[model samples]
Target: MSLNHVRPWKNIYRRTSRQIMVGNVPVGGDAPIAVQTMTNTDTADVAATVAQVQAAAEAGADIVRVSAPDAAATTALREIVRESPVPIVADIHFHYKRAIEAAEAGAACLRINPGNIGDEKRVKEVIRAAKDHGCSIRIGVNAGSLERHLLEQYGEPCPDAMVASALEHIRILEDNDFREYKVSVKASDVFLTAAAYQALADATDCPLHLGVTEAGGLVSGTIKSAIGLGNLLWMGIGDTIRVSLSADPVEEVKVGYEILKSLGLRHRGVNIISCPSCARQGFDVIKTVEALEKRLEHVKTPMSLSIIGCVVNGPGEALMTDVGFTGGGAGAGMVYLAGKQSHKMTNDQMIDHIVEQVEKKAAEIEAAEAASAEAAE
Candidate 1:
């Protein structure tokens, strides 16, 4: 491809204001889309907690959050924070002391819902410790556990109600001159969560941490998160996102990236476009696509790759993407690159051939981009 064919990828959306650091990772204000997940392991288990944090980091989490409910978990935070590959976020609920202990233990950030922490004096104490430790905080307000006063006043967890709750927490932080923080008002219902986030986005510039709270296991959770986070992301409303699935936290990271990729907001791994199985499908497309997706887990490039079941739509779909393969007769398929036929190969050869082509083409594209950037500079 020539320079004339290169189109600029401009993300014109208005990013939220405020700047907070989770270790070395910057959240909000034009930073790259950050991937975050919480560890499900017991926080008091030092070894287990450290292991899970490391696992999350290896799986590409930029920030790892762990719940510290007691004094033992508070003590464990020191070692966990020390050993973590990425920044550790100490998640504290209903306990202001744990937040202080987490900050003292060198946690990079603290996740606390201000309304749940109680009293102006206690809040200031946590904030003082956080400022002393140079740690950031996340004001995480959930609909299921909104303040009783706010709930009684609003009569329900509506969007306006959620926004009111978030603002109330924001006021608490602002009252103490604590600006190193982010906010999230999450509800289990997708539409309600999206609406709440949208309202908050309009009201303030704090980096909004997005999620569909208490979103259930694997399939259902993924769908709920995709719907809620995806909608807010499409409107340019989120900064860092966590897909709160009941499944493995790694899956949360994966789904978070997928939402970003789908919105053309960011790209991480393979972008696979495959057809739904039909009578015209010549090969095991469902199996092939699933296997290909799992196999290409580590390919982190902005490359569009397609796997098609039949020639009718395959070649055209492949042409529309960066690389693709279409089914052909007698256990064979045709591979297309940049919309042109590269070669015809056997069904078994399909995966390897497409992967090789993608890697090679990706290198070429990267080199071209570098050269263009240099010329511009």
Candidate 2:
């Protein structure tokens, strides 16, 4: 049973938007908020870019974006899209030709600003290519790269300016009879990102792609994204999300899932609820969790595990998780399965034991779900 079932207040009333397919994966219309990350590799290096995309897909990325800044990159995109396990979004800047080339190369989506892709002729050519190739477009509006007119009008890159820029780009797509698209209004500042998204959410029914652009390196970026994306998601604004970090794309996928998991919006793998160890901890809590995380990365089952330091709040937390370990006296801990004290194990052997238990529990869950579906059929 989900916590939301028992606690109605936990429900996030998601905003309804028209769904669009990014390759086979669905975005919007109550679909899972797709997680996205961009590869920093030279797009011309097909092997390297494809490897990065695969790594991110294995880590649960629903979509991956690769830059197609030039003709060479767009040519390489053909092979990259062929080999990629998840949807490939070709990132295009001011060059409309790259947009057309990427669409021809089998990109699932094109990330372009219709306003920046030269005059109406170039924009229409890009739009026609996208339509001919069944590619969705993403109108990404960033505060740092706001149009000069918008900047002059608003006198700054504010929420209003960002929203206006996005609306202008959206108007171009709408004018071109392109509705198979999503929009994003991003900023490095959390307040601006959240405010723009909030305003945009009210202004249009298009599926939103949420992000805080240029959000620094791993730690700082994750924090900024969690705050910015987290708030908008809580308000039922986003339809898909990308956590912009200066780290590896795999890290971005992991962080994106973690954010969605924290909000109970989406779940994948083990959702660990471990405590920061204190002096009262019977086992090495930090090390144990680190080992468990790496060991259980292969488990794609959505489940929770609580590793609490002591009885202070251990048993209480254990009661809610699918599997739990609570520290106790004499270098031993209690293993709780399905919220019941099932057994005890020494600290030295607990990590392996916990892994085994979680794997067993996940298999059981999968089997039961399969049986239920079979019965329905």
Candidate 3:
């Protein structure tokens, strides 16, 4: 394709409400779309919880949520909060006391499914405690369990019912003069969840936390979450997202970023554009792309790179990326840099050569960013 033929990138986005801070990282308003994950370890186990929290942080999770189920779990919060690399969210259920305990223990945020958390007075206490501790709250209303009155009114856990439930919870907090919070109305069913969130988005300006609850194991879960969250995000509905995979929490963070990237919302790491192999593939496309991906797993750059299997589509794709390789003729590949042909290398040298070039480009980018930061300072 010629330069003039290149299609202009159309804006496929709806303006998200706005960004709001969840701790330091912004969730909805104008903040970068944050990637959040939950710790599966027992929250009272300080070492394991801290380790998991740190692991999620190291794995690029912008925030980590852990369950504070009991008084012991609340006690562990102080230490866990002190050690967490990113702000910590305490997931409290049913127990208003635990919410207060978590708030006092230094949780940056508290996540509670308000429908199940009991009376208005208790809810008010939870809100007051959060206000006292400078903590935010998430009124996470789930489809699995809803307020009995709503269930009777709607007959089943429908989108309208869920939205109503979420509003009721939001009303409680707002009436109590507590406004520093986010909301999530998650349903195991993607359609229901997405619809509910869209409805809620209209009814409130509070930032939304997107997820497809009980999203099954890796493959199905990621797909469901992507489609559900991605659709809303494309419509400018979500502020922060959690890809609730039944796999490792780290994988959740990875998939969260992937969804954001697919929507052109954010890019945190190497965005590898690789083609599926055909007989035309001159090199081992799978192995090379996999190797490159694994090696650059920790490289936190927003640069796009292409690793194509064959020469036919390679050049076009490579030209669209910041850097890349085009495979052709046995054991040979051409490198593309800054949308132009840079050089050619043999198959065996591909990985090393690509890595070296990427490292150099990344360093240059980092240096430029540092210089910009210093100039701003």
Candidate 4:
């Protein structure tokens, strides 16, 4: 039984939206909310860009975006797309021609800022190119680049203005008889972004791509994105998400997955639950968790591990996790497997021992799943 069924408050009723394809990945209509990231590497550097895309994919990104700022970038995109482990989204700005080129270069989606992509005729051309290439479009409306007319009408970037801008772009695509698209109304301010997305959700049934744009470096960006995206996701508004951080694309992917995991919307690697160590700790809880995190990075199996410092709440927490370790006296801790007290280990050997146990448990889970699948087949 799922936790949501037993705990009603954990339930999230997602908004109904039309499904669109970004290559082979579905964006909405009951599909898993896809996590995405954009590469900071120069798109013209095919090797570097492909490496970044692969890294993000390994970290569980469903889609990766690369800037196609010029003809050279789009030219390089052909090879990047060919080599990418996940679908590639070409991020295009003012140049509609770049969008056209990107579509032809095997991009699964073209992320174009509608406000800056010239007049209706140019948009129509880009739409036609997207259709010809079986590529989807993303109408990216950012607060920093709202249409001049919209800014004049609203006096500033607000939720009303953002939704209006998105609607205008949606109409252009609809007018061109194109519907394979998603939309995002992003702002740096968390409140503004959340408000814009809420209004966008009510205004259209298109798949909404969520993000807080220019969200800052790793630490700041992760927190801002967690709050903004977490609220929207809890309200069941986003179809896909990107954690915009001024860090490596892989870090963004990791943060995106962590947000999804926390909401119980998605799960991938080990979910570590640890307490901040106090004097009550029998072992160096902080160092042990840090070491375990680094060691368990290669474990992609979805599971939970609790590294509690003391017995006060540790045993209770251990009962709910797949694998757990609770600190005790005499320089040792108790290990719990599958939510039951299993054994004990010295603090010095705990890190390596826990890593071995986690790997073994992951293998068991995978094997059981495979056996069940085979039986069904």
Tens digits of lDDT, candidate 4, 1-377: 11111246777899999999999999999999999999999899999888889999998999999998899999999999999989999999989999999999999999999889898899999999999999999999999999999999999999999999999989999988999999999999999999999999998999999999999999999999999999999999999999999998889999999999899888888999999999999899899888998999999988889999999999998988888999999989999998889999999899999999899988988898788899999
Stretch of 10 with least lDDT, candidate 4: 1-10
Q: Write down the TM-score for model 4.
A: 0.97
Q: The CA-based lDDT of model 4 is what?
A: 0.93
Taken over the whole model, the C-alpha lDDT of each candidate is: 0.85, 0.91, 0.86, 0.93
Please say which candidate is ahead in TM-score: 2 or 3. Answer: 2
Candidate number achieving the greatest lDDT relative to the actual structure: 4
Which pairs clash (backbone N, Cα, C closer than 3 Å) in model 4?
none
Stronger candidate by TM-score (3 vs 4): 4
Model 3: residue 31 alpha-carbon error in angstroms = 0.7
Model 2 residue runs over 4 Å out of place are 1-6
Better of 1 and 2 by lDDT: 2
Write out the backbone clash pairs for model 2: none
Question: How well is each residue in 100-137 modelled by candidate 1, as lDDT tens digits?
Answer: 99999999999998668887789889999999999999
| Predicted candidate 2 versus true structure: per-residue lDDT over 1-377, tens digit per residue | 32212257788989989999999989999899999999999999989999999999999999999999999999999999999999999999999999999999999999986446677778788889999999999988888888888888999989999888888877877898999999998889999889999999999999999999999999999999999999999888899999999999999999999999888898888889999999989888999999999999999988889999899989999999889999999999999998889999898999999999899988988888788999999
Model 3 scores what on Cα lDDT?
0.86
Residue-level error in angstroms, candidate 2, position 328: 0.8
